[model samples]
Target: MKIIIILGIFLTSIANAGEHQIPTAPQKYLDMQNPIVKMDEQLLKITSRLYKRKCSKCHGKKGDGKGYHAENIEIKPAAFSIPDYMLNRKDGQLFWIMMNGSDDTEMVSVGPGTDIGLSEQQMWELITYLRKEFTK
Candidate 1:
């Protein structure tokens, strides 16, 4: 009886191990071509500074959407790391949001000469930086 129980346990363990095997990474997917160009140091600096000055208030320091003032806002800030949320928003939509702001939330327009000021170029750069950094 003891040997039978031990053998059963051993077989179950082996079966479970085989069933729960980790999936291997696909080399073909990893080797797929992408057209994104790397940003220069100056561009990176501008992105970092812009994020610090304007975005850090609500989007957080690392763009994790947990800024200092986030708690006080009625709606929680969007998490950049979320692929579903990021995928739904297009570059044009994001640009419009940056320029015109959302009426539903605390987000406000940061267009040229506005209180939360940002030029069109700056907003576009910000959009580029965010898309590159967050999207998979």
Candidate 2:
């Protein structure tokens, strides 16, 4: 009986975990794709560093959305490793979200004039890193 109860709890937690969903981006960005065809190995390394610097705080080091600041934030961060949901999203959509940030949510625009802004190229790099490292 004890083992049964523990198993049920574990299954419940797993079910609840995958329920967190990132809202969809606007239509314009929904069809966007990563335009960088010549992704270099060095750029991939730099992209990892960028995610650690800019995204890991709330998205977690593994992109699991359970980072240190996750508990305190109103909107939960996205778990990039979620295959089913993330795979359905276009790379361009991710780029736009990273660029403009989600409104009424903790996701802030990491482009320019913001606390975590990145250059356009850098944004693309970050997106590339995210897709490569996570979302398998």
Of the candidates shown, which would achieve the greatest lDDT relative to the real structure?
A: 2
TM-score, candidate 2, is 0.76
CA lDDT, every model vs. true structure: 0.70, 0.79
Candidate 1, residues 13-86: lDDT per residue as tens digits?
A: 87864554212224543343323245777997888788888887788876778889998986666667675666
What ranges in model 1 sit over 4 Å off? 1-38
Positional deviation of residue 92's Cα in model 2 after best superposition, in angstroms: 2.1
TM-score per candidate:
0.66, 0.76
Kindly list the per-residue Cα lDDT of model 2 for residues 31-133, writing each as its tens digit: 7666675568888887888888878989998988888999998668988887775677787788878887877788889887778768888887777677777
Question: Candidate 1: lDDT of 14?
Answer: 76
Clashing pairs counted in every model? 0, 3
